[model samples]
Target: LNHPKLSLCPSLIMTIAFAVRWRDPELVGPARKTPRETKRLSDIEDQAGLRWHVPFVLFYRGRGGDAGADAGDPAAAVRRALGEALVPYYPLAGRLREVEGRKLVVDCTGEGVFVEADADVRLAEVEAAGLTPPFPCMDQLLFDVEGSGGVLNCPLLLVQVTRLRCGGFVFALRLNHTMCDAVGIVQFMSAVGELARGLPAPTVAPAWSRETLDARSPPRPSFPHHEYDPVPPTPFPPPGDMVMRTFTFSPADVAAIKKGLPVQRGGKKATTFEALAALIWRARTAALEIPAGEDARLVVAAGVRGVRDLGLPAGYYGNACACTCRRCPPPGPCGASR
Candidate 1:
């Protein structure tokens, strides 16, 4: 990542003053209750985790000096809240281990790491510059990505809190995508925020029954599931150049797109997400300039959080998402509406 061309990105302008590793204080200690044996991942949980890392960031506005006594000290509060939050979300404190089957399971070690840093830039300047993607702001603030071995050897959940010059801060996280999904991480953060706000405990305690998402014992199937089928290993091609970009859609714009979608006769109306996804799929296909006889695929992530029959509890904070691929002919107006 130190390539000269990459450094030309605007976010590199923000400098780091000091970065220190903060571990859980002895007083808070590790969670007393943890799984005894290695928690195996389901087959549906693809091995792509071996290479993927999920990066997320949270922005908090600072309370000026006159705000309150506790308001002046933010880092201490975050440490305290994190220590308390680790009690229920203990798996995050663990390290990845390889078992006999060559599969990885968490060691439940109770030793997550946090990095606290001081940034030279102010929060206002960052917001003004636009925190768009290729999310350089987050990359600049997080200190864990360097030197730490990839997902396999890195901490299960690593956090970086950058104190902006204007007193506000940016909380950045890099989690092993193999351990949890975006929903699960957000739930974990919500619990930490609740504790920071003086709540005695999280509203929903975490459940770690990876077996809950397993396929039926006999592997009975009512329909074909080609998406979840395993494929033989293939030679990996060398890396290619790719450009990362992000597009923003306001609530009003999203609503307008949904309204424009043709509704089914006497059926349910399309959701805002479905409408926007279809629009993007069509637009992207049109831009690809592929042959009409060829096929185009779109992989969409579907969360099983609230599906009644899955029997997943409110706090089942693990990988509970499935990636479904839709194949269509690269012809006129992609009408795939998933």
Candidate 2:
């Protein structure tokens, strides 16, 4: 509605303008505030923002070994998992890419973002001793990588492990929020699991190409520089039964909100995304106690798929998103008809 010539515009503009909306925060995970380091989170942010791509790091807990007080040779188990994972690890295992004199590689060491410890140890003793890593899934070794500026530093996910009662290693794949959304992580992990088990993943990569997915030219930052305001930290690491949190909304509730809205007869139907986004914009403003006419933004994101689609190469890795925002202060309560 903001654009004067959107429909008549090229496919690129239509894709950029006609984003589906949802009340949920499509972009929930925030990058950790940049700690002093050689590599800055901003570099990743800028690179991803331009392309509308995000990164997702997954931690997997392997099957635990025989009864033992200490985790038995985790590095070896990790190596075996790597060997089994094969092609899924290909993107990471391949040679370094020197981009204008920078190296890009993977954590062949297997222990990424975690210190592999014996899961056999009793939790009662571990918790009573009070000497556990900040979390339980300690199988993922580390998250060190070279890019943008040597040593990418962000904890999209820090993996760890625990011994379940059934003796299966509870591999906790810590996910980095700044990289990709939960759904994206799930897709990637399922692919990895399929490969580890020697089965074909249930995915057909999307039709992707830089030419097809990238902006024809540089994208004119549609929304203002900043969209979501800095949210005060919430309960340490979102509470959940598993490693990540997933959500579902009732169809009736969604339809009720959509029914209240009026749209141009010729325009696209109001989607769940639009309804949710409009609701979030108002909620955030009200929660912060800003004036009724204040403005805010809502962002929706999707990852770019290359020729392979879901299994597309990593070069396509970057941000793909659009923001719904209040252009100027409103005279009454915040309204999308802005």
Candidate 3:
């Protein structure tokens, strides 16, 4: 990951200072009683590398009127919606336990963390500072409760809804990576939103047939799995000097980039993602001054939900993606081209 220096003016920097008063943490269970069952996670899901929490945040502008008046108590609404959503996605409310051979299983304990908070800033102020990646005071915004950060025998999902003084709220959550990937989490959150909006049930029912993705007995290796191979360590700048930035490209910018690329023999133009990824990879390689003799690689995660053979149901929210690596050798013509 490249960390370019952030150049912000003095006025913009002042917006970073804000205090969030967090309420006592509470455990929310399914609105209705869910079955008490233990289910083993797929081999891919419980891999040693996937035992961690992934944090995400979303900002919403305040509705007209005083805080909590027009919104009608967002914290309570979120809590209620999450409880109802947990009825089908109960595994998320369960705690992860390690059984024999270090395998992971959901204990179906029916408990998830929820925190209500209030920030002393307006939504407009936050947006003016730039509503992008590397958000300011992320720790306070998320608020990792004590004893809630463990990988095993801990809450699988932790949510904190911070209401801004202007009535807008920040929705943040930390989800266990072992349980699901980005797609899975998004599906679950969407369901919660639907229920909050008075939907009878989730548009797509949640499914938990993880055994379908389990490895076959006496695993057969069909192709090379180089992604899991150990990678040589590379030097990095000090953490203090590293800064993450988000870049936005308009549709015109994307069209311009695609126009510069060589046309395909079949007349199929490169996609926006393909063009941008290629452009960034080449620019990053050049900016880092990597040696011409060294190999540069880009790893992209491709979704496998569309694969009919996998038999992943409509709402199978497990890790159903594969990482493909593309290696570029030296700064050749392909890398130099627009």
TM-score per candidate: 0.79, 0.46, 0.91
lDDT of each: 0.67, 0.36, 0.84
lDDT (Cα, tens digit) per residue for candidate 1, span 51-107: 467778878887764223346656666767888888888778777766675666777
Candidate 3 off by > 4 Å: 1-12, 68-70, 333-338
CA error at residue 25 for candidate 2, angstroms:
34
Model 1 whole-model lDDT (C-alpha atoms): 0.67
| Model 2: per-residue Cα lDDT over 234-295, one tens digit each | 22433463253234569988998888877746976788987877766665555555543444
* Model 3: per-residue Cα lDDT at residue 54: 96
Task: Kindly give the number of clashing pairs for every candidate.
Answer: 0, 40, 0
Please give, for residues 1-338, the per-residue lDDT of candidate 3 as tens digits.
12112222233345555667777888999999999999899888878778999999999877777695757778888999999999999999999999998999999999999988887778888888876776656777788788799999889999989888888888999999999998999999999999988898999898988888888898997986766767666556688977888899999999999989998869999999999998998887776667776667777888988999988998889998787877766585354211
Q: What lDDT is reached at residue 306 by model 1? A: 81
Which rank order by lDDT, best down to worst?
A: 3, 1, 2
Residue 333 of model 3, lDDT score: 37
lDDT of 3 at 326: 74
RMSD of each: 5.4, 17.0, 5.4
Return the top candidate by TM-score: 3
**Model 2 TM-score relative to the real fold:** 0.46
- Model 3 C-alpha lDDT versus the unseen true structure: 0.84
Q: Which ten residues in a row have the lowest lDDT in candidate 2?
A: 19-28
